[model samples]
Target: MNLIGKKIKIRNFDENDLGQFLELVQDKNNHKLAGLEYTNDIEFGRDLLDMYRRRDGSYTVALQDNNKMIGIIELNKRGESTELLLTREIGFVIDKKFRNQGYAKEAVQLMLEYGFNDLQLTEVWASTEKDNLAPQKLLERLEFKYIYEADQTLPYTGQHNLVKYYLLKK
Candidate 1:
């Protein structure tokens, strides 16, 4: 799964991405904000391998110039059922060092194209914590209409609920 954007490339996960994947998931701030549990490199690597084998809808986001692993983006299914394929949830996490560089936006645009064009998806949705402005802005910039906000505690943050955003194929 290789997706080329203007500045970022969404590629399949591999062993070579282990080091950077650990670094991204290890950050206390990043993990907490993204609702990810803290884990050591070994556990993280194992989880990555397991998810890759599953191959539901995961991709490694990297820089195109040097092919450096910087983040991850995924289009997840609403349920385990294969029948529900057209509607997926988009999720992403950018490296702290790479934030504010427009990488996340570019990566998302590429994924949106893949979802609507290649996958023939009818709609795509994303949820962000109330306090998370970056993703909200990204979704808005991409013309994803505001759906609604749900009140549910985040296990990792335990502070705020989530706001869902939606976009239809155009």
Candidate 2:
């Protein structure tokens, strides 16, 4: 699947995306802010993509002009039955170099549309580190309602971060 926007596009991960994907994960500073990581081995990167494809939830955000990947985004189903199935958790991270220039915002808008329209979701939720004002402002700008704040162990990173949660309903 591919999502096109004025400045960026979101698409399924391809083997060719490995180079840019590695750059994003291997950069220590970037993953520290994002709260995730991967090993430096090239083979490990390919293996991880295979796992991502099995779930078909993770995707790449790239420039429309050059098709160069600049970020990753995902929507993880929160539950499996009845009303719970319509809710999902969303997350994303743009390469540090491409941040603050509106790409992340556009990518998120596209995802929100997909979640509410294509997926028929009732709500999409997100949590950002309490100190990360950029995403908090973006979530508010997009009309997500504040839920609460708490200390949560990031599943992938295992880091305990003070998190502020928000949700957008369809």
Candidate 3:
């Protein structure tokens, strides 16, 4: 799926995108915040390709006018069920150079539409660290309700404590 925005476009992740995707995932700051690191680009690329092959989730690339991969957005169902009550979670990561350009918000908005419309999800959820106020505020700007907080130990760093947010389709 391709979603066009005013300044960027969100589309399905392609095999050719592996290079940029690997670079983005390897960034220290991005990996620190996201709690995952890719030590082997080829292995990670294979896993991503497998996700695409299964059609179980969506991986979208945010592109600029010249078609640079500045960010990525993803939506995954909680389980195999198609029930409306089953939640879908959304996530995004923007290139450090492209920060504060509203690309994350724009890509997230388009993903939300796809999640609610095409995926038929009744609710969508997202989470961020307590210190990551940017995403929390963005979720609010998107009208996601402040659900609650939880203790989530980072899988990579073993850090605990995280705040989760949720939004229900009206």
Candidate 4:
């Protein structure tokens, strides 16, 4: 499925997206900010393909004109708790080259529409590093209320980082 925005398109990952996916992850800044470890292995790409094939609710944000994937955005369940199903955490990563463009905002707005209108979700949340002003600004521009400040575990780095949480109610 595809979610169309003004200048970007959000769609599911497939084999054809492997190269772009690798490029997205290989960027050092992305790894640092997102706290994700990337490997230059075909198995990793296969794993991502399998993930998309599982029909999980995630999408790759791409440019409309060239169909070049520039980022990723998704609303993911917080945990295994059934009560948390109505509340999903929103996450996104834009390529360095695409930063400062409005694509992230547009893609996120599309996901918000999908979550609230189509999924019937009640709330969406996001957390970002305190130093990451871009995402903080984007979330604020979308009117996500500041929820709290806390130490968040970095997935790849295995360290605690200062993070601020934001929430938007549907």
What TM-score, over all chains together, does every model reach?
0.86, 0.89, 0.80, 0.88
Across 16-110, the per-residue lDDT of candidate 2 in tens digits comes to: 77888888878886655566565688788778767765665788899999999899899988877887898999988898889999998999999
Best prediction by lDDT: 2
lDDT on C-alpha atoms for all candidate structures? 0.81, 0.86, 0.73, 0.83
Q: What is the C-alpha RMSD of each candidate to the true structure, in Å?
A: 2.8, 2.5, 3.0, 2.4
Superpose all Cα atoms of candidate 2 onto the true structure and report the RMSD in Å to 1 decimal: 2.5
Candidate No. with top TM-score = 2
Could you give candidate 1's per-residue lDDT for residues 145-167 as a string of tens digits?
Answer: 87888878758887665655556
What TM-score would you give candidate 3 relative to the actual structure?
A: 0.80
Ordered by lDDT, highest first, the candidates read: 2, 4, 1, 3
Higher lDDT: candidate 3 or 4? Answer: 4
Which pairs in model 2 have colliding backbones?
Answer: none
> In lDDT terms, how accurate is model 1?
0.81
**Residue-wise C-alpha lDDT for candidate 3, range 1-170, written one tens digit per residue:** 67888878887677677667667767877765754354456787668555654564555556657667777777866666557345788877888788898888888888888777776677888877677878888989999988888887768998776657566554
Model 1 has a clash total of 0
* Model 3 misplacement above 4 A: 40-55, 81-86, 154-161
Candidate 1 residue runs with Cα over 4 Å from true position = 49-53, 80-83, 154-160
